[model samples]
Every structure is written in structure tokens, then in C-alpha cells.
Target: MSKDSETPEERRERLRQEEWKDNLGGNLNDSLNRGNNGSLVDLVGGLGWKGTGILIIVIVLGFIVYSVFFR
Candidate 1:
């Protein structure tokens, strides 16, 4: 449609709709990134502490058992 044929109110509404769509897309992206980052931090933190503790405990127990039996 020609710009001259479109009413001012229609033009304004169209522009507003475009702006709303753009903002919505941006907000969705931001929310997804935030959630992903939070999940990554939680995963890393959980593994860092729990994994290390379990590993250390297993290693120490293994060493003790080996020394007692094999020595």
C-alpha cells in the first residue's frame, strides 16, 4: 500500500506493532540467556563441590584398603 493512501493512525499503529515485536524478541533472548547462564553456574557449582568430595573419599578409602591388605 502506498504511504499516501494509508491514514496517519494506521501508520502509527503499524509502527507501534513493529516496535512491540522487536522488543518482545529481545526480551525473550535475554530471558533465555539468563536462564542458561544460571543453569550453567548451578551445574558447575554442584559438580565442583560434590564431585571433588566423592573423588577424594573414594581415593582415600581405596588407599587404606590396599595398604591394609597388600602390605
Candidate 2:
């Protein structure tokens, strides 16, 4: 039968199947691109201790400024 002639249930099932296939394709693509050794620790490790020290300084300065002005 033609698509236009299909019942509502058949149409809904077809759409659901298509969505499932699309999701599977996306997951496969992401996994293949990620490879091994790609993780949160690797990302944070790139920043290292220098970045962490800079971030801490900024936070402390921000707190001091807020207390002096707003409080």
C-alpha cells in the first residue's frame, strides 16, 4: 500500500523506527570519533596547575570586591 493510504498506527510506527535509527547512527558516530583516552580528566589536565591558580585568584578577588562594595 502507498504511504498516504497507511493507517495512523502504521505511520506512527514508521516515524518511531526512523527516529530510533537516527539516534543509533548519532551514537555510533560519537563513539567512533571519541576513540580511547578521551575523558574529563584529560580535558582538565590540559589546564594544569597554572590555570587552577589563576581561577582561585579571580574568585578571591571577586569575593573581596563584592564584600567591599555591596555589603
Candidate 3:
């Protein structure tokens, strides 16, 4: 239970939980924690070159479909 005995990850988790608890509302907690896992740039970077290319292709195709039909 002592902070001195806890590992780094444990300390980080404890801090995050404390932050969540001290918030005024659930929305503030949600928004604050939303980017804990990183953002879109992180996602693309994590996907590597091939995966990023595939994702781009999929997005372009989706856009084409939406443009042709919705417009």
C-alpha cells in the first residue's frame, strides 16, 4: 500500500486513478483519459508503412463511395 514500494506502472496507474477520482464529473474524466493510449498520429506510426498504406487506401475508397452516392 505504500507508494515507495510500488513499481513505476503501479505509480502511474495510481496517479491516473487519483486524477479520475478528483474530477468533478465523468465527462471530464473521460475526456482527460481519452488520449492515454495515444492519438491518430500514434496509430498511423504504430501501423508501419504497409498498414498505413492499406489504411489510406481503405479511407480513399470509402470517400469515393460516399462521394459518388451521397453527392
Which candidate achieves the best TM-score against the true structure?
A: 3
Which stretch of 10 consecutive residues in model 1 shows the poorest summed lDDT? 38-47
Per-residue lDDT tens digits of candidate 3, residues 1-71? 89899976577668868877777697475666765755564576568679999999999999999999998
Per-model TM values vs. the true structure: 0.34, 0.38, 0.46
Ranking by TM-score: 3, 2, 1
lDDT order, best first, reads: 3, 1, 2
Q: Comparing 1 and 2 by TM-score, which wins?
A: 2
Worst 10 residues of 3 by lDDT: 37-46
Clashing residue pairs, backbone N/CA/C < 3 A, model 1: none
Candidates' lDDT values, in order?
0.73, 0.72, 0.77
Better TM-score candidate (1, 3):
3
Tens digits of per-residue lDDT for model 2, 1-71? 88999976577668867876779977576567657547544454556668867877998999999999998
lDDT of 1 by residue, 1-71 (tens): 98789976577667766876779977677669878676543454457767868877998999999999999
Q: What lDDT, from 0 to 1, does candidate 1 have?
A: 0.73
Q: How close is candidate 1 to the true structure, as a TM-score?
A: 0.34
Candidate 2 local lDDT, residue 50: 87
Report the Cα lDDT for residue 66, model 2: 96
Which stretches of candidate 3 lie above 4 Å from their native place? 1-37
